[model samples]
Target: MKKCRSLCMLFFVSFSLWNCEPDHKKYNLETSALLALTSTTSVPPGSSFKLPDANQTICYDTSGVTRACIGTGEDGEFTNTPAPFLLQIQDSGETILEESSELTWQRCPFGMVWTGSTCIGSSLNVYWQVANAYCNSLTTAGRNWRLPTAREASLLADHSQNTFLPNTYFPNGQGAGGWTSTPAVGFFGRYLVSSGGNVTPIDETTNFPFRCVSGPKAPNASFTDIGDGTIEEANTGLLIKKCAYGQADDSSCTGSASPLNWQQALDYCNNLNFASRTDWRLPSIRESYFISEPSIGNSNLPISIFPNSSQAAISWTGTTYNSTLSTAHAQMVYQMYVYSKTDSANVRARCVAGP
Candidate 1:
């Protein structure tokens, strides 16, 4: 009877222990299965899931890992965190994703090797002519490629990166200099670079390297005669003085504007009231380029609208030329090129109003 009682007690203890085991393990298994099903059913491949906020911008890391709310804190404040799923990065063709601009760029810059997502090769340090030729010859992604404009080349400047460029996308690119399609003063070409952390231009020659970009060109500029000794470029929305400063004539500038130093020219435009408007200032290199009609010989400007435009005249731009605070950039409208001139050097000024 005692032996039977002991056996029964042992069985009872074993049964109690078995029943006492925690139920959490089974619950966890069930929860995991439900999550898997929900994920599969809710999110489709190549589809995006919204972040916590609708305004939050999505960003990606160098390894193609995606994250959310990685903006520069310009549009309000927010916290950044890694996204749940990796983005599908495609590197199969002549184009790859340019994360910064979110545009697809060519896998290589003309003569470089496309290594998966990035281009890897030394850039050819060629002249403006050669650079343009190389870019024109390129046939990538079934499209013709051409050299980037100054504005387009400026987009590649990434101050956050060590080389001031997105090296991951433009590997082996020269950070100091790259040629732009925009012409500088004289026979030079405009090149974009961050010299001393400032976007500045240098004379384009056979010494500089260039990168090609593929995009729609800016639309042709249209002119409207304001009839108040000024004309408005319809495309750029800039009000240009009909005649150069100091050569003010309703019909045409009989003489060239008196060449003043950079500072003098700036002050002249700022103080002088024109066209019943007080806000007159120097045009930027870009702004000056906008008015330039390279097809027109001699004056390189629309002669009928802007009469007496001189090819020999070099106009001072508001932009500084280099790291030197004392120098400024000037544009030669006739040749469509840029060159650096001292602040004290005598240069012409054509005032512009509005952007």
Candidate 2:
């Protein structure tokens, strides 16, 4: 029955089930099930998700270093020249509305109630189940609310540095980490920890701090094959290369995905010219994190969207936070990870264009 409703939604139709909202203050188990139990999505396709800048200002070299962003093609080099994540604080000041994704986020983390002036109270640490139960029952200005997915969870964190901090729009600081709805290997679910923590996959039964977000859920996988080796993602307006590094896009991306060091991977995308677009570059950490899949164990990315994918689908991002830390986003094997820039690790490169 849930599957049928999902298919109907894919064809531009949406379904509402058990919508006996006579009690707005209480959590409707049936209506809440539509968000938590059945599908990991709250909104249908065409609802956009925006990628905010990492807000990195200073550049870094391969070794112990601090530098400027004049020439280096790192994330710091393009710190909001044009495209930027626009967050609008609602009139109540308790909720925030992100312009690009159009999702309203609760200002406070779970367990901390919004007291108009600010969020007060200690954060509640509970299992994923408890977290969702709280989200369902709590009534804040009355909007459909649920736990954030991996992509939405990633956006709420402060990724400017390797450590976790308050989001620019978040008046109250975030907790250590939280449970995301996106499931990972086995019973483990994706935990959106600090930028350094890299969305660690852990047992979902464990207790952790979580935040609630209401409004449309970001699409799990929404892309249109542009027919010329590129697929344009409707949500972020990002054009990603269909093939991995070293694979030829001859209809089906053939051959093995090449493994290149961090520097080599950066160079590959920096100099890439395909589909008549020369603006291609190594994707930023946020951008790479955006192309995520919920079933991220064997391969989280949708096979129908990114077919013939490399078995080991780890790809480098241009996010170099400090001298030692950079990012590598994956669709098949690993989650978002931070690695030593000068390490001998060799990863693949999947380039992207647009903001």
Candidate 3:
């Protein structure tokens, strides 16, 4: 028994996921341990999940046409497939345990009931302000629920399909949209999961359906400027080059970046010897999230941290795009998308090192 507890502790610490006095139910120890072993990275299992998934199996070129993802150094070439998540459906399917994130979600939106097979009844579309109050009022499964943060809300998206939620995990669960707790930078209002799977700020008075989630706080990426041209993300031990490739780095990156094809981008990082370190490589799709605190808007990147990055920072990722539940995270407007590895139109490269 002691050995089992020790292993579980290691799993939680390795993934930085264990929460004290969790507001929801505890995870099944045996299952979590096995899941932790599924990771291919240095970190344990929970970190390998391909959150906010993408689905661009067919690569596109600068002219916006479909092609294959072979020699193009595109996302489809490098993205590692994530293993399946073990969903622990509980409370007679009213509650769902997303074991990978350790977040329990209400299967149906507000005003709907899980009728064993699917959610029945029309969902309530509430304003941004009411989202929190409504979620807080819930006593579902004896856990304190709240509106999910932007990051948490992103995790719910399955970009592999056009639908918001796959019917398998969430049957007939589609609503107009859902509200996130992230306040927009300006007065646009709160963020919402649009029908297209992107999170954009909408007017405060706008109504959108919402679901409740109960979990420990979501993991965030915090960075420290390394005096050199790189910043270290405290959470993932990833050191990121401040500027995208082709941009000169000094007191904030400047100069128009020279766009590289996907393959050349990969070569540039592998050959990079910047900051007296030669270990740099392109960031995987999941690793890209830990690079910098994402900007919900294009210009939100602080000049000190990511100067001159205000434009739609369409950058290349090491992860290849696949039309499965397991791939893609190219960032645009702080939202996730896929770029054809061969598309030289606008996508640039940002190199990273250390996990």
Alpha carbon lDDT of residue 111, candidate 1?
40
lDDT of 2 by residue, 1-355 (tens): 4234323432321112213323223444453444445236646666654556756667666663667776566667777522465678884877887676677887777656556667666666666555665566546677777777767766654445544445555645555368777655454354555434356776555668877778777665577888998988765678889888888887778887887777777777878889998777777766766565555446756667677858246777777754244433333353676566654445678888774
lDDT tens digits by residue: candidate 1, 1-355: 4234423543554355346434312323443344223111112344332211111133222222333422211111121211111111334644544332233345444345665555655544654545655566655566656766544443344323336444554556546346656544333334443322233345433446555655444333457779998888764567888788678566877776777766567667767688898767776544565565543444646788887756237777654432233355566642223333433445787887764
**Candidate 2 at residue 299, lDDT?**
71
Clashing pairs in 3: 74-341, 75-320, 75-321, 76-320, 76-321, 79-320
Please tell me which predicted candidate would have the highest lDDT against the true structure. 2
Ranking by lDDT: 2, 3, 1
| The best candidate in terms of TM-score | 2
Ranking by TM-score, best first?
2, 3, 1
lDDT string, candidate 3, 1-355, tens digits: 4234423433443243224314223434563344223211223445533332233344444344455766544444433322233457788778877665566788887766676788876666755545665676667778988877666665565434556466777778474258876655445456676554455666655768888788664565667888899888766567888887888876757787677766678779878889999877766554555554443344534556777753247666755443332233456555556666566777777888764
| Model 3: lDDT of residue 337 | 65
- Write down the worst ten-residue block by lDDT for model 3: 34-43
* Candidate 2 TM-score, true structure as reference: 0.77
Ten contiguous residues minimizing lDDT sum, candidate 2: 9-18
Regions of model 3 farther than 4 Å from truth: 1-86, 160-164, 173-177, 259-298, 309-312, 316-330, 333-347
TM-score for every candidate vs. truth? Answer: 0.55, 0.77, 0.66
